[model samples]
Structures are given as structure tokens and as C-alpha cells.
Target: MDQPFRHIIALAALALPAFATNARAEEAALIDGGKLLLTNGVTTIEGASGGGLASWATIAGRGTDRGIGLSTHVTLIELPDYGWQSHGVALGLANRLELSYARQNFDTRDVGTALGLGKGYRLNQDVFGAKLRIAGDVVYGEPLLPQISVGVEYKRNRDAPVALTVGANAAKGADFTLSATKLFLSHSVLVNATARLTKANQAGLLGFGSNGNDNHSLQFEGSIAYQLSRRAVIGAEYRSKPDNLAIAKEDDWLDLFAAYALTRNLTLTAAYVDLGSIATFDKQRGGLLSAQLAF
Candidate 1:
């Protein structure tokens, strides 16, 4: 790992043990899985809670205001020229704070050989994230107030050499996001909007910004969903991303997704995604499937 990445991990390591000890001492008082179904939202690509392509203001897990909860998920994506898989774990505290970690692998497949990087080459990344709910509630409290949150994600690219060779300025960077979300009980609809500041290329799979474009840019993500039943929802999401690398012309991502709760603790999500172009290859559309377990 790079020096900065090592420092980030070490800091988390030092704080986690102490927090875990305290949490264990109050385990009985802390864990109460009482949130309503699907209100906590599904896991996003980077492991935060929301739609597959966008993050929402809702926290992770099915925890109530006075409880702690855990969630885990695995996601897979199949594209014409690439393959993607990611898995992660998240912790929600008092339905106000969330901490998450995810690992992503992007397989280049035949495109790797065409680019002279050998067939089946892969790019890997690790994302560490934290979010704090600042106000309101998604399904309760003031009807139009909405839930608001601020978050940050630090991403580390595992293939630093390749990233540098491709003109990326750094292999590690951070993204800051602000989100607002609301659920209208009368209409059975949920809406969310998020603003992000980032310079990552392909969400840091290929790396951060190119040498020529190292500045972070503002982006937007929006989602709208309708509740079909108590346990099922269909949604659509659109996410704009920064095109910071000169070698690859990146594009915005959009998806139409459906999620169903099989049980109080398990939910499955499926989506048809259009990722646009990636690394000079066009029409990189695909299907995404994910499974999440929460308590």
C-alpha cells in the first residue's frame, strides 16, 4: 500500500477497537432492528446505502434512532467488454451515522489484450466511507423536510503503476457528497438527489484525475422510485460523473432497478445499466444483480 493509504487504514484500525469495545458493553441497549422495510435503502456500488448507481441520504441497515445495525452485500455486473464485482460491509449507528468499506474488481478481459496489457487483466480498488445524517427522516417526521446527509469516500487504486502509466496523477483520492431524500407515504414514492465533488476516473478503478485534469468537479445523482407493495419497489437512477482522464472518455451512468425483500433480513436487487463508454470502448451496457443482508 502507498504511504497515505497505509495511514488511512491505520487510523481506522486504532479507532475501531475502542469503539467496538464500547459498543459491546452496551450491546443490549444498542441493537434494535426496528426500521421499516426498504426504508434503509439498498447498497450502492461503492457500498453506501441507496440505489445501485447513486447514494441517498438514508443511512445503512434497518436500525432505528436508538439502535445499531449491520449490513452486508455482494454485487455483480456483466458488460460487453468488462466484468465487475464488489462486496462490502456497513455499520449504522443510531440511524444517524454510517461507516462502510468495499472492494471492487474490474476485469478488462479481451480489451486487456487489445490494449497490450494481456488478457483478463483486472483493476482493483478499495473504498472507505463515512456518512452522518444531519437532519430530517426519510419516512417519518416532517412530510416535506426530507433526510439530509453529508458523506466522504476515500478510494485507493491497487494498480498504481498502471494508473500512472495511463496519465493519472494519483492512485488514491476522496469524494465528498451531500444528499437529500424523501419518501411520500401518500403517493408511495421516494425521491433523492445528491451532489458530489470528485476527480476520480471510473470511480477510481482506473485511478484519480489525469495529470492534465486534477481538479475535482461537481456532479449530480438523482433517483425516483415507486413502491409496488410493502416489500417491493421499482426505481430509476441517473448519475453524472467526471471525465478526468484524457485517455478514456467517461460518460454518465443510468439504471432502471427493482428491489424486493425476501425476508426482514434479506433483499435482492436487479438493474439494467447503461455505463456508456469505458476506456475507449463504447456501448458498455449490462445487467447488475446484488444481494444484501441486514439486521
Candidate 2:
């Protein structure tokens, strides 16, 4: 198997052991799984809990205000000229603090050959993220109040040499995000909006910034969802990306997705995504599939 797939399998193996270790005398108190179905939000490409393509203000697990929770996910995206894969794990503490890790591998099929990087070249990156819920609640706060969160993500590109060769100023960078999310039970609707400060190019797959333009810029991520039932939701997301690389033009991303809870602990999501352009390849669109398990 490929190294990245092996790493994912190893990470999956740790989940059961870790959960078992925590299921001691205080198991009931720690793993209550009290949150409503689908309220925890699905995992993002960066591994934080949110919409399929955008980050939301919701926390990561099914834990309530007093319990701890764990979640893991694997996501795949297939494009005409590229393929994407990511897997990660997350820990939620008392539904207030969240920590996550995700590794993304972008496969540059024939496009790599055109770019003189050999066919099937792959770019890999690791993302480490942390989020803190500052105030309010996603489902129970005042009608006008929404859940608010602040988060930070530090990304490291594995192919630093390639990144630098593409005129990127650095192979690593950090991003900050402020998000707000609310679920209106009466209307069966969920809404989210996030503002991000970043300088990463192509979501950091190509690199961070460029010598000519190396400043962070404000970006936006918005989502609106309608709950079809207690365990199902359909939503659309829009994420604006910065064009910080002079070598290539980047475009915003959009997706229409549906998520369903197959079981209390397992949720499945599918989406059609439009990732405008990547490395000068325009009209890059694809389908996304993801599965998340939480407890």
C-alpha cells in the first residue's frame, strides 16, 4: 500500500485503543455522546468539523458541554486532471475545545507531465488545527445569537523544494479563522459564516505566498443548510480563496452537499465541488465523498 494510506490505516487503528483507554471508570461521564445527530458537523478538508468545503463555527464531536469526544474521517475527491485524498483525527473536549490533524495528497495526473514534474506527481501537506468555542451555542442559544469560534491552522508542505521552485516564498504558513454558526430548529435550517486570514496559495498545496505578494488577506466561507430530517441535511457552501501566487491564478470554491447519518456514530457525506482552477488548470471540478465516525 502507499505510505499515506498506510498512515491512515495506522491512525484508524489507534482510535479503538484510545477510546478503550478512556472508557474506564469514568466512561459514562466522559463519552456521553449527547449532541443531536448531525449537529456536530461533518469534517472539513482541513480536518476540522464543518461543512464539506468550508469551516463552520460548530465543534468536532458529539460531546455535550461536559463530555469529551473523538472523531476520525477520510475524504476523497476526484477531478478531471487531479485526485485528492485526506485522512485525519480530531479530539473534542467538553464540546468547547477542539484539536485536529489532517494530511492531504494532491495527485497531479497528466497535468504533472505537462508541468515537467513527471506524470502522477503528488504534493503532500500536513495541517495541524485547533479551535476554541468562545461563546453561545449552535442549537440552544438566543434566537439571534450564534455559536462563535476562533481557530488556527499551521500547514507544512512536504514537497518544499517543488513549492519554492514555483516562486512561493515559503513552504509553510499559518491561517486564522473566525466563525459563527446557528441552527434554527423551528425552520430546520443551519447557517454558517467564517472569515479567514491567509496567504497560502491553492490552499497551501502549491505553497504559501510569493516574493511579490506575501501578505495575508481576508477570505470568506459561507454555508446554508436545510435539515431534511433528524439525521439528514442538504447544504451549499462557498469559500473564497486568495490569489497570492503570481505564477498562477486561484479561484473561489463552491459545493453542493448532502449528509446522512447511517448510524448514531457514523455519518456519510457526498458533494459536487467546483475548485475553479489549480496551478493554471481551469474548470477543475469533481465529486467528493467522505465518511466520519464520532463518539
Candidate 3:
């Protein structure tokens, strides 16, 4: 071959390897199939779904990529005589970890006076959280092992003292959680279990505490999810909390959820949540909807 032709051939050969490397890197950055929304627990996303111990082996943190993503959720609850609502947004950075912020609004309806807070009393709280994947494979040839994650959250109450007494002094507090997850490739199912320690003063707003009381408690959360198709999944979760208040007895909640992926960058989730109750209020039930976007 002529010298010019030989030189061109050499340059083309070198470019091929670089292109292949870039392709592999891009594949690695994509989220794995077993975990939806880059979360280890059930569809709840937060600690409510527990971690890796139940049925879904999904990990909680983002993947190992250096990208950012966003998630938002809205929740509604129906009490015996009142209704409550909450909205939240979270940001994920890289695939190694995530940071999130959430706000909850509660409408007392007619139960406000019965709870000593009065009618139309609304309470709001803010939550800040971080999640880190400590171990496990993001892309694995074998399907039995799932990822592991560790995380924490700090909650601040924005409710006025006279309006809501449960979180009067709950200005700043923390929750620590650990999770383990595993995926069954043959069955297309994921299981996750998690344990947490918290002094959050409320379920951070799910309402499990009162003012003048601060006690550390342990909670267990678990979830199981099965992929119904390439873009859809169904799951459930259960959480156990503590009753650290002199005014109320904390109860547990169960959740059933469904999620659908619209595209590589977007997904939507919906759930039916039975919160049971927080004290003498024996009937509390709710629904939640969420959307997630990744880039």
C-alpha cells in the first residue's frame, strides 16, 4: 500500500478501540434492570419500603455513574373525617449516591380538634437525606446477589407550635438505615430488607410522636417486587415503627405499588398505602404517586 494509505489505516484502527471503550462506558452507566428507580427497597423509594431484606434485591443509591437525576412524589391520605397530603422531590448524583429533599403537608379536617390541634390545622415538615451504596455489583452475570446500601436522613419540622404539638422541638434530628438486597434472575423478582434507628420525633411527619418526648427507636422495613414486563413492575412493602410519645401509640403501614417506565429517562409509580393509625385514630389510609427523571 502507499504510505498515505497505510497511515490512514493505522489511524482508523486506533479509533476503533476508543469507540468501543466509550460504548462500554455508556452501557455501564445505565441503571440495572433488577432495581427500579435505582432503589433497593420496594416502590416506596424511602425507608418506608425497607431495603434489601424482603423480596426485591434492588439497592437504594444511584448507580456508579457520575450523573444527576431527579424524583418527585405526591401522597394523599384519607382519615375517618379528614384528608392529608404531601409532596416531595429528590436529587440523585452519580450512581454512587443520592441526596433528597421532601416536604409533607397534613390537613386535619375535622379530626384536628379531636387531636387537640383544631380544625383545618395543617402541618408541614422538611426532610433531607443521603444514600450510599457500600457494596455489591451494578452489573453482574450471576443473578443471585443484589446490591447493598447505607443511608441517613435529617428531618426538620416547619409546623407552628400551637398548630401541631408533636414536632414542636423537632427542629433537627436524624435517622440511620442499612439495607441488603438480592435478585432472583429466574423468577424476575427482587427482595430487600432494611433496619433503621431514628429519633425523628414523628414518622418525620407520618405522625408517630409528640412534643416533650425524644426517644431513639428501631424500625424494620421490607419489600418484594416482581417485574411484570420489560417496562412494568409490581411490589409491596411493610414498615414497623415505635411509639415514643405520651400522647399516641405508633402503628405500622403496608404498601402495594406499581411502576411503569416511559422511556430510558422517565418512570412513573403509584401505590395504595394503608397507614393504620397513630394513637387513638384507628383508621388511616392513603395513596401515593411519583415520577422520576434521569439524564
Best by lDDT: 1
Q: Candidate 1, clashing residue pairs?
A: none
Q: Which stretches of candidate 1 lie over 4 Å from their true place?
A: 1-29
TM-score of each: 0.91, 0.91, 0.73
Q: What's the best-to-worst order under TM-score?
A: 1, 2, 3
Q: Cα lDDT for residue 50, model 1?
A: 89
Can you write out model 2's per-residue Cα lDDT over 1-295, one digit (the tens) per residue? 4333343344344344444554553546787899999999999999999998899888788987667878999999999899999999998876777789999999999999998899999999999887877788999979989999888788889999889988899998878889999999999999999999999888899899998888999999999999999989999999999987777889999999999999999999999999998988999998999999999
Best by TM-score: 1
Model 2 CA deviation exceeding 4 Å by range: 1-28
Candidate 1 per-residue lDDT over residues 1-295, each given as its tens digit: 6444454455455445545665666666666789989999999989999899899998899977666879999999999999999999999877777889999999999999987889999999999988878789999999989999888888989999988888799999988889999999899999999999999999998889988888999999999999999999999999999988788899999999999999999999999999999999999999999999999
Each model's Cα RMSD: 3.5, 6.4, 12.4
Candidate order, lDDT descending: 1, 2, 3
Separate clash counts for every candidate: 0, 0, 21
Scanning candidate 3 in windows of ten residues, the lowest lDDT window is 48-57
